[model samples]
Target: MQIEQQAAIVTGGASGLGAATARALAARGAKVAVLDRNADGAAALAREIGADGQAIGIGCDITDTASVLAALDAARAAHGSARLLLNVAGIGTAKRIVGKDGAPAPLEDFERVVRVNLVGTYNVTRLVVAEMVKLAPLADGERGVVVNTASVAAFDGQVGQEAYAASKGGIVGMTLPLARDLAQFGVRVCTIAPGLFLTPLMAELPQAVQESLAASIPFPKRLGKPEEFAQLAAAIIENPALNGEVIRLDGALRLPPR
Candidate 1:
């Protein structure tokens, strides 16, 4: 799947990982549609990349089917159907299934996490695949590619991360099956499980806490950068052989139980 001249949709494109991906895809010469709930932020980014003349910003709530459909329609109108789907919009709220008081956590807490991270990912992927199937296949019969975002917490979840972990774990678990399901359609699916990184949310932490987390990494001894993740995504798009795998971007660090 060549990134050049292709229509790419990036969820959560307002900031963090999605933002980085939008910039990366644009740098690679692809027409990018920035889909995010932050309407102003998304529009700002599209303008930032407007030099390419193929970038558009759409406000969307991936958890809602109608919202996603509207966004997809807007993206299609702006730049044809998307050939690259990047599912990076997600919430990371840490909560224990059982609070310190031992009372069961509110059901909404769990559902909210899954809805935004897991269900939202599927919503975008499903709609993107529907469009990709309609596009003619390129070399090697490849029509499109989907890259989902997960977290190391899915495997090394600590205390107070039950909901978050489960949501990400669902992403990792679905990778292979999704790849297989889309294989016949010449579509590929893969996931990225990133470890502690200096995203905007992490940047909000105190310096001491940030340093502590960085020190925890075995090598490099620093947080992962959004650009590094984008680099990997570009590689994945360039290499068709990469599919149906959850590649971890942690710097040789296995999170400890908190």
Candidate 2:
């Protein structure tokens, strides 16, 4: 579907990949709603995108039904029902199932990661699709599209990444099923499993560490840019045939076991 003049909702829009996507969508003439847990950051980015009301920012916790409902309501009120939903809000953890001290990992930690990454993604998608289905189909018989974020760790999980890997793996697992379920409604689903990239969290590491991570990629030996991710997302939306696929944005990099 043409992104121009469409309403788009991007979760985790306050920063990182989500921020880049919001900006990209807005640039393509989509009225964007930046939903994030960071209220101030979200509002700030919205202001940066456009002061003429082309975008809005709402504080949202995708894991909470009430929060998501309120966010969707506000978004619809401001920009009409969203035709594009980008699920990018997620968290990571680095804890071994059996720690060095020979203790089991905290169950809460695993639950939190899965809750935010997998379950939270589903929560937002379900709510957004509910409204998207009500809208009249476009010329292509498409009502909406959803793009979810995963990680290469899902497939190449290293030591201490059990929680993060499992959570992202769930996203990878659900892509095709989600597409099939939403086919009748003309909503497509896809996923992106990104490798090491310079996100806000990654940037916090020392320069040497960052460079080391970048060197692991086989080609274009540098970190993936957020704009590159945004470009792919926009591409997925435009290409009607691309559905239920998980494309890796990692410069041909296969992560090593840590």
Candidate 3:
């Protein structure tokens, strides 16, 4: 689908990759709804994007049905039904199945990660797609497109990453199936599994730690950029043929089990 003038919803739009995506979509002339749990940040970014009404920031919790419904309603009211949905809101945690003390990991920790990362994604997608299918198809017979965010850890999880990996792996596992399910409704689904990138959380680490992480990438020898992820997401939205695939933005790096 062409992004220009289309309504787009980006979860986690307060900061990091989601914020970058909101900016990219707005830059491409899409009427953007920046949805995030960080209400202040979201509103700030929306203000930064424009006060001329090209963008709106909404506080939303993707995991909650009521919150998502209200957010979708607000976005539709502001910009019309969204044709582009970016599922970028997620959380991560690192907990080993067996800890240093030899006690089992907390089930609540595992549940929290999956609830936010996996279930939250599906929650927003289903709500968005439900509305998407109601819209008439465009000239290319496409009603909408969805892009989900995963992590390279889904493929090669390291020590103490069972919860994180399982959550992301669920996303990776659902890409093709979701595409198939949505194909009949003229909506396409795809996922991006990104390796280490210089996100806000990553930036909080020491310089030496950051550099060590950067060196792990096989090529370019630097961390991925949020803009780079936004570029691929835009490409996927514009390219109708790139459906049901999980493209890793890892610079040909396969992680080691640390």
lDDT of 2 at 154: 91
lDDT by residue (134-229, candidate 1, tens digit) is 889996899999999999999999988989999999999999999999999999999999999889999999999999999999988999999999
Whole-model lDDT, candidate 3? 0.94
Worst 10 residues of 2 by lDDT: 45-54
Ranking by lDDT: 2, 3, 1
The 10 consecutive residues of candidate 3 with the worst lDDT sum are: 45-54
Could you report the Cα RMSD, in angstroms, for every candidate shown?
A: 0.9, 0.7, 0.7
lDDT of 2 by residue, 147-253 (tens): 99999999999989999999999999999999999999999999999998888999999999999999999988999999899999999999999999999999999
lDDT of 2: 0.95
Ranking of all candidate structures by their TM-score, best first: 2, 3, 1
lDDT tens per residue, model 3, 10-48: 999999999999999999999999999998998999998
How high a TM-score does candidate 1 get?
0.98
Query: What's the residue-level lDDT of 85 in candidate 2?
Result: 96
Which segments of model 2 are wrong by more than 4 Å? none
TM-score of 2: 0.99
- Please, what is the TM-score per model? 0.98, 0.99, 0.99
